[model samples]
Target: MTTTNDTRGVASQELFERCTQIRQLLAAGNANFHAIGVQYNLIVDTRLAEKAGFKNAPEFLTQQIKELSRSTLVTYGAVARAFSAEVCSQYGVSLLNQLIVYVEAAGVELDANDPSTMLISVPGADGELEEKFFGECTVVDLRKAIQRLRRPTSSAPLPAEVDARAQQCSAALTGYFPQQTGVRVEVRNRKGKAVMSLKDVPLEQMEQIAALLSTALRSSRAA
Candidate 1:
């Protein structure tokens, strides 16, 4: 049960609050993101949409919540299921979304008491890889971390010469890509069902990368 302590900050001399923004705002313009998300969960969970003569959530979205995109509703429920109001406000909408994605994709929970085990490679001050938690990392760092985690795990070792040649090719290609492109190329070479993926990249950046790929493929012989 949520006691007075939970809302007032500090778990009644027990736990410390990491996120202090506790006021729940449900006003249309105010957007207490996660709290609104909680309402979303309830609506879907209780079949309120069905009662409203909608075939499904998508229909409900199209008919009533014209402004709410399908993607927003999906992620909103995820955010609501994942964290409390305070954590949602503290992390902000983007981070909370990333948090859910990380946990689901990595198959691990975010344990506040044991953030050490959650350690992953993140860029340090000197621009070198350092292990850190999501809370400790900047937004850019978290994005990089999620990308690293989602990358396919190699099942077998490549021959030394092939690996070296690939590294050189990668370096060359990396140098050619402009930093402003906001595009990334990933090679998910691994045994089994591993597939390439792009996470959280904007559509404009994706279109840029797609254009590059189209140009490259046009010149190359059919693979």
Candidate 2:
């Protein structure tokens, strides 16, 4: 994978141990992402990379934080910023992130503490909508749930050609980003739909991806 390296850096066992803590804790299961975020925040906030002679956090993270991808590190920060340490203590980090996405995308008012039910104000939703708790929602389940919410208003089902084309586009994105994690691309037959999820992409690459999409949209309009 192509990593953006910081200017020359010296190795520090202390920093290495700090980075390694993320891996070690996660492996033990039930990792508290907020705690991991604290360490990630420290490294970035204090510019710990420079202490090791590296120019930026990306370089330090990529080189020093081995095995774990940049996306995983970013999730630590997301969970820390989005939820309390107490809230995140029991929830898996991915679940927390997905819930945030679901709320934002679905316009659903949710109590993170009570995942079993939520009050979503959509076209026909009335009062508190009794729903399954989301602790077990896989990424694919997330996409389907979102789609179902908008089903009445959603456009026609994705044509097979479009689905195939979208798959190709997703593959191209993977080829280009290479190091990204937790990406999901699915073509559901029953719904004749395709969903491509790109989450936890590193901050540095986000602008590039956004710009690429914007440019494509412009060209499409012009054409």
Candidate 3:
């Protein structure tokens, strides 16, 4: 039993608010478009539509983009493909995983246990030979689950001397290594686990330290 006057008043108020919001959004969109055009030095001549087979400049641009899609330039191919796929999926992009893959493909030599490093293992010439290499170096610690990733070795069975020597070497070399003066090395055990961490040592020096640790561990075990 709502009164006609009251219902009309509510509808009118709702319509007014919606109109204001729509107007604001339209203004913002126009501003953004103009900014983009200026930045890109685009000539937005509306008259070019007839020659370009479109009713308006915007329509002309849209068709041009579609044409470009069929034969994409190498520089824009990957980005355009990703953008189109995301738009088809309601603007959802698989950014994080894709970036991780890209980062992990950039090669850099590093110890297997290094928390900042990722290793990619590939098959070698022989079926029994596996080639292990370092990929991207990152500051973000993926330590906990990194072992589950493709690694050359495991954790869990490193000699106590390996840990001690790595720390000693880190203390010995204070100002070297890219990105940080205090270099840290994380070594993976045979099981692909990062069982030791050493900081502030040069890559070459760390190798020597590892070799020494291996010998000491072997001798102690034999004794």
The alpha-carbon lDDT assigned to residue 134 of candidate 1 equals 64
lDDT of 3 by residue, 1-223 (tens): 7776666566445433433443443356432222323211222332333333335434433343442222222212233332333232331122222323444543443222231233444333353423232333221222212433445544465566665554444443322345455555554455623355656666667676667556655554555
Best by TM-score: 1
True-structure lDDT of candidate 1: 0.56
What TM-score, to 2 decimals, does candidate 2 have? 0.46
Model 2 agreement with the true structure over 1-223: per-residue lDDT tens digits: 4223432233355566777886676666656568877777777887776666667665677675575578877877877777778778766677777777778788767675566354433221442433455754565556556656645442557875665566555655566665646544333433555555676677887787777656544554454
lDDT of 2 at 172: 54
RMSD of 3: 21.4
Model 1 root mean square deviation, Cα atoms: 14.2
- Residue by residue across 1-223, what tens digits does model 1's lDDT show? 9665354343212111111111123234445777657666766775654544446554555454456677876777787777777766666777667765666677776753333346557655665778776667566767776776777667666655544444444444445566675545454457433234444456656576566545544444232
Better by TM-score, candidate 2 or 1:
1
- Provide the overall lDDT of each model, using Cα atoms, as 2-decimal numbers: 0.56, 0.63, 0.38
List the candidate 1 regions with Cα displacement exceeding 4 Å: 1-31, 112-118, 123-128, 158-189, 192-223
Please give the RMSD of candidate 2 to the true structure: 14.5
Q: How does each model score on TM-score?
A: 0.53, 0.46, 0.20
